[model samples]
Target: MSTTRSRYTQTRSSTISDDQIADLIYKLQQLIPDDQIHTTTLHHHKALNTKVLEETCNYVRRLQREVEDLSQRLSELLQSMDNNSPEAAIIRTLLMSP
Candidate 1:
């Protein structure tokens, strides 16, 4: 298993002045139609959902690996018990019981 770190960082600095922001907004209002904005929002939401699904799959796979390891260890412990031991015979009986 391997992990990767994102190198891209969110910008904390805002160089745009208030006047520039107002100008940009005014231009955006003129350029982007109201109907298209809804489509844009939907696209962003789908992208977010994809990321969530990917993360969930990774977690499930890791848990499955841990469960398999625990099962193998349990099997080994049972096999190490002598067949003549009372407790071991009881365990075998329990396992074989219908």
Candidate 2:
């Protein structure tokens, strides 16, 4: 399996334990102004969501750039191949035959 797939599987299988949840709830309860908790939590979640989206976009762009670089290198290598060389001639013949 791919490294990314394995990591995702591992993360998916993991869950927050009940003790953690309880601790979180206890902490939340300690905060002042209970009426503003909901709004504060929503804002915090929104900020996290935005950060995740930005990171995902950056990763995608990096992958795209890597793919483009690989494509350019492959084109350069192909261009460097001697047309008169037996291997190149054979490859051209095989490609044309198909």
Candidate 3:
């Protein structure tokens, strides 16, 4: 029947989406910096998953911005200093050492 076929298709689509969400959440868990997302009781809730994914994405974006700002500042500092100066040498050495 048409109705039965439609229902089966819908169920298949839903299962696929659920599997995709589970994969995303697993990757996110691995990327999380801390052991804080306990999530033992709330993983089945769609709203909670959305919230967690949003927060994680925002946090990573913020970190990216911070790294960019710091790199720019460091570049400026190096550019403003005399290339042969002791401070520049020390900075270069530190960077190379670690």
Candidate 4:
């Protein structure tokens, strides 16, 4: 007889929750109307959706630029610290250590 064991110990759960689905459904309902729910209206909806998505992407890009600027400023400030300062010495030691 042979004994078998599983190597995997954990299971992954879905990233999307019920609340997210409900919210998406609500947004879709708000975007679509019963009278305008025909195939002919799809193009109009698609254009509006594209516009909104583009705006969101632009906003995200702006935020990313701001974050990058702040990070660069922080790095410059850290680099400006005196090498003999306690904080700078600790940082240098940590960087040199394995």
Which parts of model 4 have CA positions greater than 4 angstroms off?
1-37, 83-98
lDDT of each: 0.50, 0.53, 0.59, 0.53
Query: Which candidate tops lDDT?
Result: 3
Taking all chains together, each candidate's TM-score versus the true structure is 0.45, 0.46, 0.50, 0.45
Q: For candidate 1, which ten residues in a row score worst on lDDT?
A: 1-10
lDDT of 1: 0.50
Q: Best-fitting candidate, measured by TM-score?
A: 3
Please give the TM-score that candidate 2 achieves against the real structure. 0.46
Model 4 vs. true fold: TM: 0.45
lDDT of 2 by residue, 1-98 (tens): 13323433444455445476456555554553545548759667656655665565566556655655554554454467885888766645543473
Candidate 2 C-alpha error for residue 23, in Å: 38
* Steric clash pairs (candidate 4): none
Check candidate 3 and list the clashing pairs. none
User: Candidate 2: how many backbone clashes?
Assistant: 0
Kindly give the number of clashing pairs for every candidate: 0, 0, 0, 0
Q: Residues 1-98, candidate 4, lDDT per residue (tens digit)?
A: 00000101111122334466456655764665656556888778767765775566566556655655554554455568885798866755653477
Candidate 1: residue pairs that collide? none
In Å, residue 73's CA in model 1 sits off its true spot by 0.7
**Where does model 1 exceed 4 Å of error?**
1-37, 83-98
Model 3 error, position 70 (Å): 0.7
